[model samples]
Target chain A: MISILKNWVRGSNKLERFWLLSKIEYKLRYYENKLGLVWALIKPLSEIFIYYIAFEVIMKAGIPHFVSYLFIALVLWNFFVESSLGTIQILATKKYLYEYTNMNKIEIYLSVIGSNLIGLFFNILMFFVYYIFIEKGMYVSWHIIFLIPIVLNLVILSLGFSLILSNLYIIAKDIQQIWLIIIGLGFWISPILYKLDTFRAALPGLEYINPISNIIINARNVVLYNHVPEWGLLFWGLIYSVFFLLIGLYLLNRLGSKAAEKL
Target chain B: MELNKEKVAVIARNISKTFYISEDSYNTVKKRLFNLFNTPKPKEVAALKMMNFQIDRGECFGLIGRNGSGKSTLARVLAGVYPTDTGYVKINGSTMLMNLGVGMSHELTARENIYVSGSVLGLKIKEIDKVFDKIVDFAELREFIDTKIKFFSSGMIARLGFSIAVNAGAEIMFLDEILTVGDIKFQEKAIKVFEKSWIDGKTVILVSHSMDVIKKYCQRVAYLKNGVLEYLGDAETAVNMYIAENK
Candidate 1:
């Protein structure tokens, strides 16, 4: 485990690989499209517009400051959904890469995560532009910096899930369908669409157990309320991320070689 | 670290790997329905059974075997891509090259794939950077360096992949019929690179169907039959044994 961790960190210069892969990922997505990177902005903006109409206007939820709340949640939710779904199929999707080359399995995991992050970063940049300029000078607070930790935790968690699911998918082909169901179920349970305060009265126990709930709630707290993350919940989220990461690495180390054979 | 001046670089002692071959693919509904009643049974296939051999440092070893002979299984085991069911592998240095260009993405450019692929072979970015230009020149894809590899022909991709693997600078290397791709000119260039790497004291293990390639490059060779090491000795002897048995 020590050797594996050592190799993961110092053994591979991740920064260089990350930069190269991120660029490649971006280029690949926009390779033939004339719109190219403009889609990055257009995509989220369109999503926000649709959601705003359906949830805020039509549903007529009487919550205070609902537009800003929905926009912020959308930003966070987009990162989570994109990263998780993207990461899940990364290994299986790139099976040809493993079959034809001598590249490390872990790097594939990193590349997907890195690629998603580039998109996530651009989304965040756009989010700020909309929030500060378009939304008419929403008060900027230092707590927005909390996005760093949130992004880091999301990356680790997404990678952990990707590694496990991808490896499992190799062994069990039906996992892709199972994963889709789980994600669909997870979105409702998660606080992405709803505020935790609304749920806290009915299901107080869920706040402790559901890691994503905590992440979403904390992100909202920092961004909307200018409050720090709850230390206990933060600790739990870290534990969840770390535990999944270790499990993912263990599976990768054990079965990564057989991936080519099985694929 | 001065390269180990010894003759033997890799020694596999009674290495074996067993794989569980499932009888059939089960859809989610079927698997769930079946799980409610009983667990599904998978047939066990012994992919490799107690295979053993030794390759000297700087020696180019050849493994010639027909499909389902466990040639790829052994290569994966040696590359630490799979753990052995039994026995072990002792290596003096890193086995850098295995299945070349495995895990590369077409969405990535030739330059980007090099780093991702190189790191998998344990090559640092600086080291890859040093040989980056040389690799591009060798692949002869300088014009399309920045273009996404998806745009390149399969042969061009193979050429770029081969260049990176050969130049990744591992003391030990494994090639599994990866040369079968690319044109004759590229194959010739690849052979020259293989020869140069071998002369520079890099241990090479090559699996190929071409008898001429085996005889010309490898000093020692092994033949695997039914997941067992059937023959091991001089390349010429093994080739002859393989030919006689197959015929």
Candidate 2:
């Protein structure tokens, strides 16, 4: 374990391979589309606008730039959902490369999460630009710095979760179906569409247990509310990320070369 | 028939692998949840059973077996595709699985797939650029290099795949039934390359059902039966035993 960790830090080959694969994967996602990555933004923007029409214009749940506010959190939520579902199929899909070459199987999962992150990063940039510059004077503050940790933590959590899901998915494909239901339920339970402040008051325990709630709430705090994410919660989130990562590594090691069996 | 520098190339010791076939192949979450009430267990089949063998450096070896006799499984295990159940497989030098379409992407053009598969075979893009023309020339697909592989005939794709795998410069090459493909002319050229360098040096393990090809090319051969090493010795004897058993 020490040696493996040491090699990861010392060697750059794995990182290089990760970059090559993710670059291809990211490019391939929009390869066939004539409009290219505009489609990536268009799909989410359309969904957010529908919600905006219902909540802000129609229902008068108007709380500041509520549309962009809602968009920011929903965008982050989509990243997790997309990354989770996408990562589940990475190993099974790329079985040929990892099976044939000396390439590490974990590279498949890493490259997938890495590739999805580029899209999520762009979405965040677009939303923040519209929120701060175009929409104007929403009390932008130093708390915006927390957005860095927010994205980093999301990637870490996703990688950890993905490592576990992709490995289990090899043997028991039922996990994918179960994951779909969990992801569907995840959106409702998390504070993506609703206010975190309300959830904090109404069901504080849910906020603590559900990491997704923390991520969405943390994103909203930096991007919209202009407030610092709770440091204690953020610390817990880091620990949560580490725990998942360790568990993911454990499960992957347990599966071993047996992963290619079902494939 | 032995070279002076007869170093050990591959030492495979007591390797074994078992695959579990789920009773319900399509066990979705709904069915699995239901199966919790009245469950059926996955059935395990040992694909390779405690097998030991070695191939010398600069040797051309053939693995022959009946279908499902673990010939391909052994190659895959040695190639590090599937992990063995319990054993050691130590192979010197870079290894590549020469099964046609080992990493061919149908959506990508033949040129693009060359890069994709070349990279998968551990070649940097720059390295592929240096040998790109040679690979294209060898496959004789220069005109259709940029055409998507899906549009190409099966033989064309196989030829392209074979060309890339061969030129990838793997010191230990594992050719799994790819030699049997392509035209007579191409096979003749491939056989020449085999006789010239494949015999001169660079260990090659060929897994094929063609006894004639095995007898013609292999210096020594190993015969597998139901995951067991049934025979390992002179090529002619192994081939005769294999042919007789199948008969």
Candidate 3:
């Protein structure tokens, strides 16, 4: 546990490094585009619009505030997808540091996640703005306080999966292709466009097992529905989060030093 | 005169390293499983032999060898960049490896690279900020500090890399062919900084094919002949051994 937070006490310089690198990464990602930072919001907004047109207009979905609902889910899912995929490929792009310098291995992944967090922050803030003013469903409730821990827990969980994927990616170059397929399947598996209750009502036991579905449900209850998240489910989510985090830490410790040599 | 062994800055013992250079092994699960039942083809290239050496604090050590003689590998192993296959390396203080473009991103500005590169060398961002001006001044790229590095010339990049590594406050420095980079003026400026580091008593492990540099900068030198430590004593003997073997 201390090992995870050890970067902090080791110095805030690492935190600054993460921030600086993440900023450059975030900028480099979109600086080439003519649209600049507007491209960041354009991705999820267009995604939300397309989903709205598909399920709401064509299928005539009965859910109220469907655009807002889809926006929240799409934004969060985009973060997850970008983060995991970014984590997998990040080492190859940033291998210069390890090959040429003495950088710690975990710093690469942390910066990847940090870049995603920058994007996610804007997306979440936009959702809240659309929720409180333009949309009628959510108010600034005390339940929103739980959004902090909820998102953090999900980030940890996603990082765990990414850590495992990154190590695997080093050995297997085509892991990204396989991971892309898994992520595509994962989108429909998680409760994003459809309501979480539909999943719970349709398949009672499976929702409890899928951590992705659980995070979406818990997040929706606090941010979208403004209902208290299920504590029992969150407790399980926390357990899985911790479990994946431990796995990631172990793999990174083992494979990190060897990463440069293997490359 | 013998240096104080108790104040050793780096100790490398029987360090051996091999690279799995064979491309026959499957990288994917499907491919790996298809060939699982078959006997695996194994091939390895030994980069370093069972080399043992120790550098006391304040020693300027040079490694000289022909191309692919594992001089860079030995320097990297000593810097803890590559792990030894069969032995251990112990470094007593903060270390930096000085290579071409070292750890800076070309997409970033010189100012931007300073912060991240400094942090990569284990310096705090605040500490980096304090030396930021000094780095730019040392690099002689004051006019181009905010300019994106991709726009800079090769000489400018080398200057920036040298400035950061020298100012990173690492006690032990591993330099690999970095002295050969850039123009004559930049090299002269870098040698001045290096002379200062020597006076300040920093431990330096310099790997260069230039005999004049090894003779001028190194008090003691080691010559590696195909990953074997052929000579490890005075600079003159090592340089002579290197010249005799190469010719």
Candidate 4:
């Protein structure tokens, strides 16, 4: 713990830099658009609407409180998808930052993920607003606090994939298309628009393999169901995130040395 | 101002760098599958080969070479942008490479660019705020502060880049072809700034094609010929060597 504190103090400068770069990234993303900030909300909202039309109206999943249920999981999942995909080309795109300055390579990944986190926060805020007005009889509970760790888990998981994929992307550009297929399948595999128990029986040990599954499960438990998170699953999810993060950071340090040269 | 010749600021020992240019990159799995038995070997280009040099603290050192002579590569290696293949570079102070429009996002405004590049230089936002006005004033870009740099001329961009390096730069600065851009007036202003206060107690590694700017400021110069240090001594001899080699 003391070491962690020491690292935080030492990293105060990097943290400050990360915050500024992320803000620039988030702003620059919508800089040219007329709607600007509103586009952040529009993306996830539109995704939820389309999924709702397909799952609830047409297919008739008929779970409970479908909108909020899907919104909670979709918001978390979108952050992972967007952040990882956005970062695949980050080392090449943001070469200017590190090529001339003494900026650490990890900071580039942080800024991109941090920008996605901003979008995630905005969508979560919209989720709460929806919960209050649109969804009736759902009481606010302390279980909501669990969303913090769940969100952090999602961020870490996305950062892991970002680090790994971006490093591979420097070597091979085809990781982009391959990752798209993976995430498309991942979207269906997780309980985003479907029931968890149905897939849990079919694909045993999925929560352990797919960290997003555990995160979605925990998020829904805390926000919608008002139940405490499955502690076992939370522990496993944390393990998976950390495991991925360690490997990603390792690959970044090892294979990412030729990043500037390759790009 | 006399520099502190006692303390060493930058040191490079037997460093070399080689780049591999692959004719065919099997980026996709399909390409990899089809070419499973035989893969194309990458062609090697030796950017720098067995080079060694050191600069004292606050020394105005110049690096002169013809195009593709590894001057920029050596500068980058010393600036810690590119790692050497064989040896290491030990820099005693913070370093910044002031290449052409480097670290400046064309899509960002001058204000935003300043903050981004400043932060990368290890300055906190509050710290940048203190030096913000001075940077804009020195660049003579007060009016275009909020405008995106993409709309600005290359000369204006160079001025902004130079100003940022002057104000918010590191202790050890690698200036790569910074004088090539900008108008003659701005170049004169930049030369004046360098002469007046910028070079005081700062280790500057200047890479330039202009012999006049180099001869004026450099106490010593290193002339590189095709990745090898051909000459390292007085500025006049090195400049003459580079010119004669060109002919």
Highest DockQ scorer: 4
Local distance difference test, per candidate? 0.74, 0.78, 0.80, 0.86
Model 2 per-residue lDDT tens digits across residues B82-193: 7777988876655777776666667778887787677666666677788899889988999998798899998998888878876764667888887666889998877776
Please write out the lDDT profile of model 4 over residues A1-263, one tens digit for every residue: 99998887676567788889999999988656899988888888899889889988999988888888888888888888888887888888898888885567998888888888888888889999999888988867998998888888888899999999999887778889999999999988897888888778888887778778999999999998889999999989998999999999998987677787777
Interface root-mean-square deviation, candidate 2: 2.6
Selected candidate, larger DockQ, 2 vs 3: 3
For A1-263, candidate 2 gives per-residue lDDT tens digits of 99999886544344555677787788878657799989988978898889888877888875777777788887888888888887787776777676665556777777788889888878877887777677766757888899889788888888888888877886677788889988888777887666556767877688778887778777777767778897877888888888888888888887745666666
Error of 3 at A14 (Å): 2.5
The DockQ figures for the candidates are 0.41, 0.44, 0.58, 0.61
Residue range B1-247, candidate 3, lDDT tens digits: 3435569998887789987765675677778767878846668788888988899898889989898898888888888887788979888766777778677777788988888777777777778889999999988999988899999988889888888887774678888887766789878877787788653678888888788888888988988888888889999999988888867
Model 3 local distance difference test score: 0.80
Q: What TM-score, to 2 decimals, does candidate 4 have?
A: 0.92
The better candidate by DockQ, 1 or 4, is 4
lDDT of 4 by residue, B1-247 (tens): 3334458887888899999898976566777778888887889999888977789888899999999999888888888888888988877766899877767888899999999988888788889999999999989999989999999998888889999987888878888877755778878877777766657867898999989989988999999999889999999999999889988
Between the candidate structures 1 and 2, which one is better when assessed by DockQ?
2
TM-score of chain A of 3: 0.91
Show the colliding residue pairs in model 2: none
Off by over 4 Å in 4: A1-12, B1-6, B236-247
User: TM-score for each prediction?
Assistant: 0.84, 0.88, 0.90, 0.92
Candidate 1 residue B124 C-alpha distance from true site, Å: 5.0
Backbone collision count in every prediction? 16, 0, 0, 0
Could you tell which candidate, 1 or 3, scores higher by lDDT?
3
